[model samples]
Structures are given as structure tokens and as C-alpha cells.
Target: MSAVELNPRPVRVSPLIKFTRWSLLGLGILYGAFHHNRFSKIENARREKEEAERPAREARLAAEKKRASEAEIKYLGELMTTNK
Candidate 1:
């Protein structure tokens, strides 16, 4: 009946359980880093590329629209002159 007897039934965790716990922790950290860092950077790059191209795309579209309008006006002017 000494100190050894006092804690004879000390809790012991199984090695398999410890390994599983650590493995899950490592997987969670990997998942978080990939999702928050890698995937986010990829998404940001795509968005930036799209944003950079948007003005050019809009300008091209505006130019096309302007050309179409000018052609229509020219056609109408020719029609009016012929009608007169």
C-alpha cells in the first residue's frame, strides 16, 4: 500500500487510437491549407484574369456595336437619298 498502489490503474491510450487521432489531425491540416491557400490563390488568379480581360472585351463589343450602327445609318442614308 504505497504510491504505486495509489495509481495502479493509470489510464493508457491504445497506440492505434493515438495513430488514428494524429492521422486525422494531419489530414485536416492538409485539407485546410489546400482549401484556404492553394485553391483560394487559384480562384483569385482566375478572377483577376477575367477582370483584366473584361475591359478589353467590353471595348471590343462597343466597337462592334458602333460599327453596326454606322453601317445601318449609312444604309438608311443611301435609301433616303435614292427615295428623294
Candidate 2:
């Protein structure tokens, strides 16, 4: 086959098909944006809740650590006295 015979003319696409394609693309973008906005709001609310509870959580942990330290010291003192 010759090079000229191998080449074919480009088929023209209908204007209606092009319009439909573009419209669908725009709709997909809008749908994605809506879902993204919803997800972001939920994520932000979760972050705010975590931040609000941080101080209480830290205080509880610190109190637990202090109690454990005191118990260790008392046990050590008792051991030393028994050894003497």
C-alpha cells in the first residue's frame, strides 16, 4: 500500500455530541467539588473536637503518672526498711 492510500481523512464530530461531552465534564467537576466540601467540613469538625478534648486528656494522663510515681516511691521505701 502507498503512503497516500494509508492516510485517511479525519471524520467530523457533531456539534451536539461535543456540547454533551463538555456538559457532562462540567457536571462531574461540580459533583466532585460538592463532595469535597462536605468531606472537608466533617474533617474540620473532628479536628476541633480533638483539640477541645486535648487538655483534659493530657491532665488525666499526668495524674495517672503521678499516682504511679508515688506508689513506686512508697514500695521502694518499704523495701529499704525491711532490708535494714
Candidate 3:
């Protein structure tokens, strides 16, 4: 076999295929960027809401604890008086 025939010829890709491949790549990148940005915004909003509610939730829990303690004390006092 001759040297020219020994080497494989380079494959030629069609312009339309190349264009479609690049377009798909570009659209994929754009979609990923948009979705990432949107996801970050949603995560930030959720974190902010959690931070905002934390204090209120703590205060409510403290109030409930206090009320329970008061009720227990009243019950104990009544029991002592009745026993006397």
C-alpha cells in the first residue's frame, strides 16, 4: 500500500451539525445559569424567612413554658392547702 493510502483521511463534519451542536451547548449553558441563579434566590429567601421566624418561635416557646410552670405552682399550692 502507498503512504498516502496508509494514513486515514480526516473526517469532515457538516456545517449544520456543527451549528446545531454549538447552539445546543450555548442553550444548555444559558439554562443552567438561569436555573442556578433562581435556585440561589429561592434558598436565600428561605434562609431569611427562617431567620425572621426564629425569634418569634423562641418567644412563643418561652411563654408556653412559663404558663406551664405557673399552672404547676398553682396546682401544688392548692394541694398543700387542702392537705392542711
Candidate 4:
């Protein structure tokens, strides 16, 4: 007997199977594109809302910090007066 076999060809795929595979791939591409656009629009809207609120948030934080500083100064001054 020889070392190698006589038949070495690969089997052929059917045309219908090929068509189904290509159509599924195209559908998946379309689904991904739609979801991508939708999510990006939602994210953009959120970013715009945050930008609109930024200045007001900063002002509120600054006011809180100033109040805390004044309270601390008043407390220390009262303590000094009691000690003397």
C-alpha cells in the first residue's frame, strides 16, 4: 500500500446556505448601526444637559464653602472671648 490516499477534495456548500448566511450578516450590520445611532444621540443629550447645569452647580458649591468658612471663624472668635 502507498502512503497517501487518492481522494483529497473538499465538499461543496449549497447555494441556499450561502444566501442565508449573507442575508443574516447584512441584517446584523443594520441592527448594530441603528442601536449605535440611538445610544449616541441619548449620550449627546445628557452631555448637553450637564453643560447647562454646570454654572449653577459651581455657584451652589461656592456658597456652601463660604458659609462653612464664616461659621468656623465665628466659633473660634467666641472660644477666644470665653478663654480671655
Candidate 5:
């Protein structure tokens, strides 16, 4: 009986296949980074918008308070004048 020798050959990949694989990987990384940058920009814009609106909200509240005080003063003046 003759001893059989088994040698496994190394598989060769084509250059085009390797290039396509690397290109796909690069595109995936770029896509993820692009979305990450976009997300940060959106978060920053939201924060800025909130900051900008805060002063307007405070001003509106202040104006409302001033109007209420003016109305109360006018009523008191009218009552005093009528009683005189």
C-alpha cells in the first residue's frame, strides 16, 4: 500500500475582488462618520435655538408683568378720583 500525501493549495483572491472589498469598507466608514458629524451639528443647532428663545421668553413674561402692574395702578387712580 502506497502512502498518500495530501497538500492543500492556498486559495488566491483576484485583485478586483480585494479592491471592491476595501472600497466597500471605506465607504461604510465614511458614511458612519458623515452621520456622526451631522448628528453633532444638529444637536448644536438645537442647543443654540433653545438659547436664543430663552431671552425672548423672559422678555414676554416681563412685558406681561408690566402690563398687569400698569392696569392695577390705573384702576387705583380711577377709584381715588371717583371718591374725591
Candidate 6:
């Protein structure tokens, strides 16, 4: 009878796997450096623009109110002077 022997195979790492790992790490770093702050700045600018428009909006509302009051007074005066 012949004796049989079994040998364990060595695991091999592919170059593609190493490349993918490095690429993913580099992409993560670049995304954080370039995109994070830009998004924040855009958000801040949008907030500031919205805040700046608030006063103009309030002024427009005030003008509309004054115009309405003038119209009411004119209407009351015309009604008082009319004869039915």
C-alpha cells in the first residue's frame, strides 16, 4: 500500500485587489478634502442671502399695509360725501 500526503496551498493576493484598496482610500481622502468644505460654504452663503432678503421682504409688507390703510380712508371719505 502507498502512503498519500496532502499539502496546504498558499494563498495569493492579486494586484487588482491591492490597487482597488489604495484607490478607495485615496478617493475617500480627496472627497473629504475637496467637497466637504465647499458644501458648507454654499450652505452658509445661502443662509446669508436668505437673511439679507428678510429686511426687504419686511419693507415690502409695510408698504403694502400703508397703501391699504390709505385706500380704506379714501373709501370712507367717498362714502360719507355720497348722497343716496
lDDT of 2: 0.98
What digit string (tens of lDDT, one per residue) describes model 3 on residues 1-84? Answer: 665777688899999999999999999999999999999999999999999999999999999999999999999999999999
**Candidate closest to the true structure, highest TM-score:** 4
Candidate 4 lDDT over 1-84, as tens digits, reads 687879868779899999999999999999999999999999999999999999999999999999999999999999999999
Give me the displacement of residue 68 in model 5, in angstroms: 26
The global C-alpha lDDT for each of the candidates, from Candidate 1 onward, is 0.95, 0.98, 0.98, 0.97, 0.96, 0.92
For model 3, the stretches where C-alpha displacement exceeds 4 angstroms are 1-9, 56-84
Instruction: Pick the winner on lDDT between candidates 4 and 6.
Output: 4
| Candidate 5 residue-wise lDDT, 1-84, digit = tens | 456547657789999999999999999999999999999999999999999999999999999999999999999999999999
lDDT of 1: 0.95
**Candidate 3: clashing pairs of residues:** none
Candidate 5 runs further than 4 Å off: 1-9, 49-84
> Candidate 4: where are CA atoms >4 Å away?
1-9, 65-84
User: Could you tell which candidate, 1 or 3, scores higher by lDDT?
Assistant: 3
Model 1 alpha-carbon drift over 4 Å, by segment: 1-43
Clash list (residue pairs), candidate 1: none
Clashing pairs for predicted structure model 2, backbone only: none
TM-score per candidate, in order? 0.47, 0.59, 0.54, 0.61, 0.44, 0.44
Candidate 1 or 2, higher lDDT?
A: 2
1-84: candidate 6 lDDT, tens digit per residue: 336537656678799998999999999999998898999999999999989999999999999999999999999999988954
